[model samples]
Target: MTAPALIRGYEVVIGLETHAQLSTASKIFSGASTRFGAEPNTQACPVDLALPGTLPVINRGAVERAIRFGLAVGAKVAPLSIFARKNYFYPDLPKGYQISQYEIPVVQGGMVHFFVGDQAKTVHLTRAHLEEDAGKSMHEGLETPGCSGIDLNRAGTPLLEIVTEPDMRSAAEAVAYAKTLHGLVVWLGICDGNMQEGSFRCDANVSVRKPGAPYGTRREIKNLNSFRFLQMAIEAEVHWQIEQLEDGGKIQQATVLFDPNANGGRGATRMMRTKEDAHDYRYFPDPDLPPLVISPAWVDSVRAAMPELPGAMAERFVTADGLPEYDATMVTQSLAFARYYEAARDASQAPKLVANWLMGEVSKRLNAEDRDIADAPVAPATLAALIGRVQDGTVSNNAAKQVFDALWTGEGRDVDAIIEAKGLKQMNDTGALEKIVDEVIAANAKSVEEYKSGKDKAFNALVGQVMKASKGKANPAQAGELLKARLA
Candidate 1:
């Protein structure tokens, strides 16, 4: 296991609770629509509003999605799961209680394997339970003075609450785990993974303790919709807790809110309410809803229909494509990226080359523009052609990058056309390249002597001079070879 991340003299302990809203079209227990951005309270029906004589009927689609997630994570799909009423009084919860799985959950005892900057780590999962989302409390843009509005549009939305053990020891590890989980849910097609639309939300429980001591009091940072905010919030909270302890202050267990704009935009956390234990919610099985049962045949069918998981696909890349483990994992980050890589590899017939460009150049551009692989301007076929030219010694790696930039900026589409227009064809004639190498050797007598005197770096310097004399048009390998021959 990786060493725990230390902050000053303390160790940070972080656990995350992620709420992934199911992709079902309707609410979990009602027929009301689950679409986002609807007008307030319009999508809510009588069952969602808990009107008298109204009863909830389980949505089969939601259960199926929960099953899909359980299988994807290699978790146990409980043959029978019970729904409980978690009593809480909140304005947005029209039912006055949330129908959720408490003691018994659908998915249990799984592990999320991911890498935090090349260090492999595994975070154990506590449980994933099926639940219904509460409505939104619109605190802004209200007509009534000094009053807030309640939007019931999101009420009764199906959600899978995934809880993790306190396994993360740093903010970076937590963010990495969250991102991996987000990608997996979207890959499985269970959740939309749209944080901006509230389709996925994270709550971080952060605490700090000295090395080799018992766990410290944890504060839950709620409703973190963005990964950036998640890391920043945990860091801010961790620092605050450590400082409090150093100054003879104790951390109080509570629910906290992270305001990114606070503390001059560096972000800070403040207490929202004291954290409540499970018993405080008064959990009890709902008498109205029957226990959910799944058969072996149903699980087997779902497994057969599921796509090849990301981990398995990554292993295939390593074995079949001759890619390194790290590269394979990176290429399989998302389904679209993996498909793009496979297409490029097949077209170019160079798996390692395609993997390098995809992870290095393509990823660099995508990250800079904050875009997805699906939205990349350079099509897989076009990228394959570029790689082919490089493999055929038509263009050097540097020249190919220039061609890629042109293609990315819409300057040109055809790789060869761009290469010709920019005069980037590599020097292939041995006579001309030999002449350039002789000229470089003659002018750089000092480097030649240094190389003859057994300085390996001087040989590289001579090769560099040869390429410079040829205006970077000479093939680098050929230049090095010619330089070596002349030096000998």
Candidate 2:
């Protein structure tokens, strides 16, 4: 990988701080439910509301999840960590000071490896700390335009804030890192990874500097919920920073919001507020909660129960199934997709064929229908059966597509049944196929003479005629072979 084209002689640098809401049933410090979409403040309890006499109690499940993520990333799970009081004032924060990790964090020093196209890249992790989510402030489309309402239902939700070193140079690399991290968390069952519902969110710190120059002043973009938006926002921000510098303007350190609707969908970002430093937060250890201590025995227990990671699984696919690295990576993108691919591969015993159909036709249809592989209309076994027919020369590739369409639309449950009903079964009888080939050769004398004179297109034309005579039931490869034999 070469560096992306310079933006006004400056290189865009990005670091991401992603918040993955833990899939725990209750809040990090309270018994309040962590479910989304509840009425405003309905889920907030006495502790979440920060009422007097209520003290914070850490959720064990949330800690266990953070440990699991640390192990997944090969990060160091600190034997002991402290929670700090991050002093801040906002309507959404029921507690004046948010509880988070500062000096010491639970997980530290890991690297995330991902591929941008065929190029492999790795982003080093700074730290991933445990924290509680703040309540939401709803101001958009309100009856009182100037006033905002607070929804504390999200308050106290468990969150793992994963911070990355400034290793990403372009928007594409940043987005790739974000996506890979998202898939890993979900694959580990620590997060649901639902960007639309705020289960995962990203904050990007972006800056631009001349090559070999010290890091430039950075602006932090907050709460980018989708990968598309993440990429768009970073690009827009980079351009804006470059343009500003060209106009003799200094880049200011601030927190900004990416407005997807701004400039008629050609997204724009606006500074929300000046960026706050760690010192500005007035951090101090929280007195209510004791130090979080994890024993090696407990970490080992969690490790023993961990699932096979995606990278290892992809390598297995490459070595065991004889798939290309790219295909294996695609298959292991998600746990469900990997399982589906393995089932189909095992059933078909044709790794390349299964990979092609799954990545091509199956993925295309799923995207069109907005369905996941788990919810695909055609099951793995069903797909395997279709592939079998194609492999055995029972149907032409075109005819196999027809069978696939029928199976996808529920026209028939069985692959053979669909093939039979649609009369898509190929002409496999050698005598019958040879007779059609001879008829085509005799009927198109001009084409035959052109083919004998070394025109490949003419031979293709004769093969096309043979397929037309067979109503597309002829195996195309077999027909082409027979045509070449006759021409020879």
TM-score per candidate, chains pooled? 0.97, 0.91
Each candidate: RMSD: 1.4, 2.8
Instruction: Report every candidate's CA lDDT.
Output: 0.92, 0.92
For residues 339-445, write the lDDT of model 2, one tens digit per residue: 99989888988888998998889988987886778898888888999999998989988888888888888888999988888888899888999999999988999
Output the number of the TM-score-best candidate: 1
Prediction 1 global C-alpha lDDT: 0.92
Residue by residue across 11-70, what tens digits does model 1's lDDT show?
A: 999999999999999999999999888888899999999999998899999999989989
> Which ten residues in a row are the worst by lDDT in model 2?
1-10
Which 10 successive residues of model 1 have the least lDDT summed? 1-10
Q: Which residue pairs in candidate 2 have backbone atoms (N, alpha carbon, C) closer than 3 angstroms, thus clashing?
A: none
